[model samples]
Target: MAVMTSRFADGLAVGTNLVDTAEAAIRQALAGLSGPPDLVCFFICGDDPDDVGRAGQRAMAMVPGAHVIGCSATGVIGAGQGVELQPAVSAWAASLGDTKITTFALETLRADDRFVVVGLPERGSDDQVAILLADPYSFPTDAFIEHSSEALGSLPIIGGLANGLQGRGSVRLFADGEVHEEGAIGVVLGGPVSIGTVVSQGCRPIGPSMVVTRAEDNLLLELAGQPALARLEDIVSALDEDDRELVASGLQIGVAMDEYAERHERGDFLIRGVLGIDPEREAVAIGDVLEVGRTVRFQVRDAETADEDLYELLDAHVERTGRVDGALLFSCNGRGSAMFGSADHDALAVRDTLGPIGVAGFFAAGEVGPVGGHNHVHGFTASILVFSSQAAPAAGA
Candidate 1:
């Protein structure tokens, strides 16, 4: 497959400015290509909601016959900084060899016994992977992940939720040369191509793993027979004032998979945020639903912890894969500048660990990757798909 990537930034003071900038970027990326691309992923960043959609349309018009899928980002990532606020667009086009591209959209994805996987083309092999872009506001992301796995039958799914303006409803998703408001879209690549995935969930576990003695769906009533909130409070109270404050603000919990025999480690647990505390019920509301019997632990997030965990995951993948040709990063919108207090922290890590290959992607509202051997909608995370060159064929027959 041939891959071409380009970014364009213009002083996007108006909608017209955004359209011009995005058109220029798409044109530049496709300048030397012999034919139309099989797939085009466009990532746009801007303050105006209407302008973002217009810019995306302009980009789609430039790349005919390519399946376009993307969304509005918290900030735009490209060859440099300042593109996020300047009405800029970054795009990556792939010309697949001997591979057929199929695109689909699932407007309403609910749990069912035999529901089809959204955003994935119907006619694909078992080896196909579904790359999804979903709207978190309307869809039950957790259930979507679970049921998608069930319906798709081990076909790995990757991508993230389309982010909006703050917590409002201004997000956008692009497909088939148009933008959408509330839905999911994906493309299935079938044929000789092989795709390798890596999810960098930047979090470290703290304390020992404790089993849930009592719980309900989305609420933890007790851990080890103690009230969930009380147990969490005790752990945070023991820390210093600064640590306590950080924990109080961004408190999270880590749930360990029961099938794994080894002790709980950093990546072993799927990290989830603490949604609310039910003082009357003595229960803790977690971002993810919990089963009656499960193993979990209280965890925290900070720059040092996040950086350490990310580096560890990346290093392990590098050692396993040896080397790579290129990489696509779908990072959480909350991570780069919001979590690290600056931009490019995750990108820099990729460059350092993987030796600077062609990298492109957007800052998604909620990241998607495999956690505990299952696909999940993650927060403050980074999911990377690394493309490596296949070994040459053996000597002639």
Candidate 2:
């Protein structure tokens, strides 16, 4: 059995006044803990940039001694519920005891024809974890994450793309009380803390896997020596009417992460969106780059499948870890009511299965988490960073 303590807590406030809502949420989160937390994370959703900035500052002031990092979001989740496309504030805090936390900011620059991500620190150790929040429009999150395997080694990087209602479409990133209009913000945690991750690409495979015979950087030209569009047409023709309707709405492609695996299962493939098709050239465009010889499968998603997928993954994590004390959930903005046609589906699932653990998160434009031991920017997915039983017990436990 796992012991529970007040080491971690979360709060959620919903209203039109952003600053007051932020303070209320922070107060609620701070109430359970004995003293100031070691780390504080917040997510705010609102239309006014000025209000969002002020609210972020107030939230930081409430926890003056802790390292703070967060960003504006389309929706905020906490207190066992999710607030979608509304004005809300969510706060999460942790008393990590002696854990070491370091905050950072990153920006991108273009050198000739290449895009370079600057401001990444050297990996501290083999056991550290990184939580990052980036502006989708300004930061090269995909490129930065693709190279993290080499740059940070085995250190797991988790978090997501911040979405804001700013007039210019740029997002706000918060680090240590200051709000940044561009780049990314994050914290690297080492020492007595451990974070376990679960990335649920809530889709089910629809047909047999096919080998990519020809591709051009996100465009699948041929599969098994046949035009990609032709293969897709055949697959769609064979599916039942309901399944075909799903494909017509939002089709997905799963790229096998390991080619040598004898069989690809649910967790074996990196799911990407099927952007569009080129009927003239008989090609299918996907969200990510595809190399020839990779196995690909057609996938479909719906509210029922998504709900089942998230709960199943959460159950597996609890089975392995024994308990989940707290968690940070980064779900894609495409989720929530947009996908599920209901509020709090993902957030409630976590609380219901994990047994009332503190959890907070936001509906990110794109979620970041490891798929097949590698980090990738994903869409229509839920990526959760779980602080397990390994967290140091509350101050005097």
Candidate 3:
């Protein structure tokens, strides 16, 4: 039996019969598995009242004993294709051999006006990766991530903030045979199975790296001993018309992830949004924390810049490690038609460069991936997990 079962394709048996759709997805996922799968995940998208939940339940029944987890999405990503605002399901099944995959569900409730979270699993020393999905409307995902950071240590969490309907949200998570309309769900992959991550923040570094000469918490007071806003104006004054327009549309700050590098590059910085500027105080507030001594740069992102950045990162991954078994993509919903001008732009890039393998995921409200070896919530980013497969010596005849 193969160590893992890997297959993914878009458009799973479309019809009024939800059972057929569910069964078809199972067949696609298990096509080449010589033995029973160890884990199964299905991400579904549709407007039908119960299509997402029914498909999830029926899909699990088809693969009895397989640990199944998934959720409904505004968009479904499969293979090298992305189906947006449509009725589609993407299923993935795997056999990790000696690897251990544990599933858990979490919900938040108020106690004495304080929000309390339930369902975080204990992490083992050998655990290396986590696949997380949560309802964006109800779950305090950012808080959960912050808490997990200290507890989980360096374990990389890669997934998305569940995207859904408005007005209480159409959030749904599937664990075992049950569908949850609230909270979060995840699978922790322990033992030797590791997740190699590629986080594309979709921005190009503008201007030079400047050290933060003065700052207080998240408020950036000064860069290179100058007012933070003043430094930004200087950078903008030097840009050409198009790039200046890009900055005008929306600008961001890039906190250097690794300061030891001789030349800071695109991937060196963790891009953050500028929340607000205090002109009177000559300071600016960023989404992420800032410190007095940290090096930083101004960054700009547009369709062309984002496209180039994602391609470069994916190409670098392919060159670094030639072997890939499968991948789980957690992309910001803003990236699909909103940023790329079409669907499947990111998926196609991955498949075109690393294809003939399996891939499945959903368009997320916020993508989770690693930057500088730490997991962080990101916007307009594509957080990918590339499953690396090692070669075993051929058996002697």
- Sort order, TM-score high to low: 2, 3, 1
User: What is the total number of backbone clashes in candidate 1?
Assistant: 1
| TM-score per model over all chains | 0.84, 0.94, 0.90
Quote model 2's TM-score: 0.94
Across 169-199, the per-residue lDDT of candidate 3 in tens digits comes to 5667888777898899989888767447888
RMSD (CA, angstroms), candidate 3: 4.6
User: Whole-model lDDT for model 3 versus the true structure?
Assistant: 0.77
Clashing pairs in 2: none
What range of 10 consecutive residues in model 3 has the weakest lDDT sum?
1-10
Worst 10 residues of 1 by lDDT: 5-14
- C-alpha lDDT of all candidate models, in order: 0.68, 0.85, 0.77
lDDT of 1 by residue, 145-259 (tens): 8777556766667888776554456778888786887777777656666556777667656556778888888899989888987887777778888777777678888888644
Better of 1 and 2 by lDDT: 2
Best by TM-score: 2
